[model samples]
Target: MNLFSDIRTLVIDNLNAMVAEGALPDGLGFDNVTVEPPRDPLHGDMATNAAMVLAKPSGKKPRDIAEALADKLAQDPRVSTAEVAGPGFLNLRLDTSVWQTLPSAILGAGASYGQSDMGAGKQVNVEYVSANPTGPLHVGHTRGAVFGDALASLLDYAGYDVTREYYINDGGAQVDVLARSVYLRYLEAHGQAVAFEDGTYPGDYLIPVGEALMAEVGDAYVDQPESVWLAEVRSFATDAMMQLIREDLALLGVEMDVFFSEKSLYGTGLIEAAIDSLRDKNLIYRGVLEPPKGKKPEDWEPREQTLFKSTAHGDDVDRPIMKSDGSWTYFAPDIAYHYDKVQRGYDLLIDVFGADHGGYVKRMKAAVSALSDGKTPLDIKLTQLVKLYKNGEPFKMSKRAGTFVTLRDVVDQVGPDVTRFVMLTRKNDAPLDFDFDKVLEQSKDNPVFYVQYANARVNSVLRKAREAGIDVDDATLASVDLSGMTHDTELAVARKLAEWPRLIQIAARTNEPHRVAFYLYELASDLHTLWNRGNDVPELRFLQEGNTAASQAKIALARAVSVVISSGLGILGVTPVEEMR
Candidate 1:
C-alpha cells in the first residue's frame, strides 16, 4: 500500500507508453526518474524529475518532454492533474478518492503499515557499545547503545536480517587494572584496609564484585602474590563487569545477540590468520612509516614494523598491525573481529563508534574491504557526546560510576522510553543537550510526550465513539463511506499518511534511524494540528452529531494516525502509550 510507489509506477508506465508509440525516443533509461513530494505543498501533491533527467539523453528540451509526459500522466485514473512547472519538473495531483481510501489501507496493514522490503532479507551485523568490560556503561556509551539498537530495529522493520553484537575489550591492560582494583576491594571485604592506586579502578560498583569474589574463593588468594592470583582475578573481574554491563543495558531495554570477547581472538591463531589472509593478498608488509606530520624528523625514529596496505582500500595511509616487538597491535584484534564477521556471511556490517573513534573509521573499513575482497560493505556511525542538565545546571557524575554518568543513572532518573527517545532526537554525529527538566514537560516541545499524546488522543476518540453507541471497530470504520472527507485539513493528514512507506525506505536506505524519530514528530504535529482545527470547526470534529456513518469515517482517519505512530515507535523500541499518564 505504498501510494507514492504506486503513483511512480503510473508515471513510469506512461513514459514507457510514450516510448512505444514513438512519442519519445526508444532505449531511454528511466532509472534516474524519481517521484517525491514537492518542496512547496501548494504546488502539487507530488513532483517528478523524469523530464529533466531524460532531456539531454533524448536530445530534446526539458519543457517539451515535461509537457508531453504531463499529458500522458493526466490520462491516468489516479492522476487528477499533471502540470509542468519551472522549466522541466512535473507536478502531480492525485484524485481525492485516492487519499480518502488511505485509512482502509492503514487499517488493513495495522502496525505493518510502513514496513518495507527494501533490505531484501540481506544479513547485516551491527556492532555497538563495545565498551571495555571494566565498569558500568557511561552516558557516551548510552548514546551509542540507543542509536545502535534503534538502527537494528529500523533495519529489521525494513526487512533486513539484523544481528546485534557487542565486542568485549577484556584482553587489554584495562581489564588487568580492573583485576587489581577488584583485588583491593576483595581485601577490604576480608577486613583489610586497601587503597586504590592511580591506574586502578576506584568506583564503588566494583565493591560488590570483590565481595562476590571473597564469597566464591573464601580467601584462598588473600595473601597470595600477583602470579598466584592475577589471572584468576582478571577472569573473574571481567565476567562480573560484563554482568554489570548486561544489567545496565537491560535497564534501557537493549539486548545483544552476541558478546564476542577480544580474549577469544588471542591464543586462537585468529589474529594471525586474519593477518596472513591479508599477507597472501600482498597487503601485509614490513615497512618504515614516514614520521607523523606534526612531529619533527629529529623527534621521530623510524623502525621496521608489520603493516597493512590500507591505502589501497581508501585509508589515508598504511596502518601498523604488529609492533616491532612482534606483539599484535590494537588494530590487529579489530581486524580479526571484522574478518570473523565477514566469514559469517553477512552482506553488510555496521559499527556504532564514539565520536573519539573518528580516526579509526578509515582503517577499520579498509580492513573489512581487504578481508572481504571488497564484497561486503562496512558503515561506521559515530555518536557524539551528550551533555546532561538538570534544573538548568550541568548534571554531576554518579557516585556509583565515580567519574561519569552511567547508563543506569539516566534510565533510573527517567524511564527507558524517555531516555531512548530523547537520545535519538538528534543526529548520531551531532552533540545533544539533554535537559531533564524539558524532556518530561507536557508541552509540544517534548517530542516524546507530544507523540504519545497523539496516540492517546486517538484512543480517546475510540472510547468516546464507543460510548456514543457507534460501532467504531477497525473493520466498521474502514468500511465506512469516506467520500465526505474532502476537507483540505483532513486531506492534509491523509497526504502525510501516504508518505509513511516512502519515509521508511528513505530512512533505511540512508541508515539513519533518527530520521524515523523526526518523521514521527512531524506526523504527530499533523495529527495535533487537525485535532486543534476541530475546536473551531464543528464539522472537522471526529464525531458528528448522531451521524454514526460519518463519525466512523473521521474516526478511521484518527485511528490510522495512531496505527502509523505505533509502528514507528515500535521501530524506535518505544512502547506507544495508549493513555497519557
Candidate 2:
C-alpha cells in the first residue's frame, strides 16, 4: 500500500468534509495537494500543503484553513497528531501502529511490495544501444544499454507494456566498410597479405567473421569485383556483428523484443511512406538551407533539397530528409524508424542515445510530433561517456575492439552485477567513472557492496534466530506482534520501507532508474544503522535471548528490508547477494 497516497486521500477527504459543513467554499481543486515526508524527521512523519494551496481558492486565510484542517486530521485513528505550521503548512505524525503494519504488509506482498499501476498498461517502446553493427559494444554503449534496460524494467514494474528494441544501423556506409574489412580478413585467411587502410576496421574480432566467411563459401568471392560481393558481404558482415552484439548484451542479461533493420526501410518504401505521412500535412518540402553557423561563404554552398519543416514542431531549424544525390540522410532513417513505432500504436516512445547524438534530440522529437500529429510523445535520453579507471589510472583499451574498450572488457573484469550497479550510481546524462579498484572494494563507499551487505546481514539475522529455535520465516514473522516496536530507531526503518511505493512512482514518472538505485542505497543505510545499534542495545537486536515472539517481531523488520531491496535491485537489473562472500 502507498502510505503517502493514503494520507493524501485522508487530507482531501477531510477538506471535502470542511466544504460540506459550509466552513469553506464549494469549488476547490485538490489536485495540487501533496503529502510527503518532512525535511527533518524531528518535525513530523509527513507534511502536506493542502491548506496553503486551498486558502486562495477558498477565500480564507492560510492559518485559519490549516488550523481547521488540523483538527479534522487529528481525529483519524492513523494520525497521532496534526499541527499547523508556518504559512498554512500542515505537519502530521502518524500513530506508531501505522508504522508497525508496514513490515507485515511487506512480508505479505514479497517482491511485489512496491509495484505500481501508475502507467496503467500504456504501450511504451524503448529503443536503446542501437549502435552501428560494425563491432562489439563499447563502454559508451554499455552505459546506454544498462540505462535503457533498467528503464524498461522500471516501466514494466509501473504497469507499462514495454517493448525493448534495438535498431540495426546497417543501411549506412559503415556497414560497407565492415564488409570491406571482413573481405580483407577473408583474403588473409586465403593466404593473401592485406593492409587495413584508414577507413576499414582493424579489430581482431573480425578475423573470426572473415574465417567463417571463408569456411562458408570456400573462396568463391576471392578476386571478385566490388559489384559481385559488396552487397552480399555487407549483409553477411552485419549479421555477424549483430550476433556479437547480441552475445555482449546477453552477457549483461539484456534481451530485446525487436531488432529492426534500417535496410528494411530502404527497399520496401517504408521511408517513403513515413515521408508521405508528413507531406500529407504540408510539412515536407524542397527548401535551400541557410549556411551552417560558423561557416565561411567560400566554404558553404546553398542547395535546394527535400526537407522537413521540423522547426514548426520546436526544432531549432528545419531538417533535410534527402541529400542532393537523392540519398536519404541519416535523420531520414531515424524518422522512419520512429514513424514505424508510432504506426504500431504505441502510446509512448523512448529513445536512449549516446551523448554525441544530443543535437538530434529536438529534430527527432519534432519529426515524431509532426508524424503523429502531436498525438504520440517521444522522450529521448542521452547517456554520457564513462571513464574507466584501475589502480587510480585510466584503464587501457581492448585489443579485441582495437579502438576502445568493449563491454566484455568491463564485465569480465568485475562481473555483470558490479558492472550494472556501478554504471547506475550516477545519472544518465552525467559522466561516470567506473573504477575497478573502488567498486569492488568491499566498503561502505561502494554502494553496490553496501546495499548487498545489508541484505546479507539480514539473512545472517534470520540464521541466528533460526538456530535459537525461533521461527523467523516470513509467514511466522509477519503475524508477530509488532506493537512493542516503539523505539524511534526501530520505527525509522519502517518509515523508510513505507516510502518504497512512493519512490517507485516518482522514478517511473520521471523515466529515471537511477532514482531506484539511490533509494536502495538510502534504505540500506537505514537498515545498517538499526543493525549497528543492536550491538550495544540488546533489545534492539533481531534475536532475543529467551523471548521467541520478540525475536520474530524484530526479524520481521529485517526481512521486510531485504524484500524491498531485492525488488529494487530487480528493477535495476542486478542480482541481490544473499550472503556476503
lDDT of each: 0.93, 0.94
Q: Which candidate leads in lDDT?
A: 2
In candidate 1, residue 18 scores what lDDT? 85
The lowest-lDDT stretch of 10 consecutive residues in candidate 1 is 472-481
lDDT of 1 by residue, 276-363 (tens): 9999999998899999889998999999888999999999999998877889899999999999999999999999999999999999
- For candidate 2, what is the TM-score? 0.98
Number of colliding residue pairs in each model: 0, 0
lDDT score, candidate 1: 0.93
List candidate 1 stretches off by more than 4 Å: none
RMSD of each: 0.9, 1.1
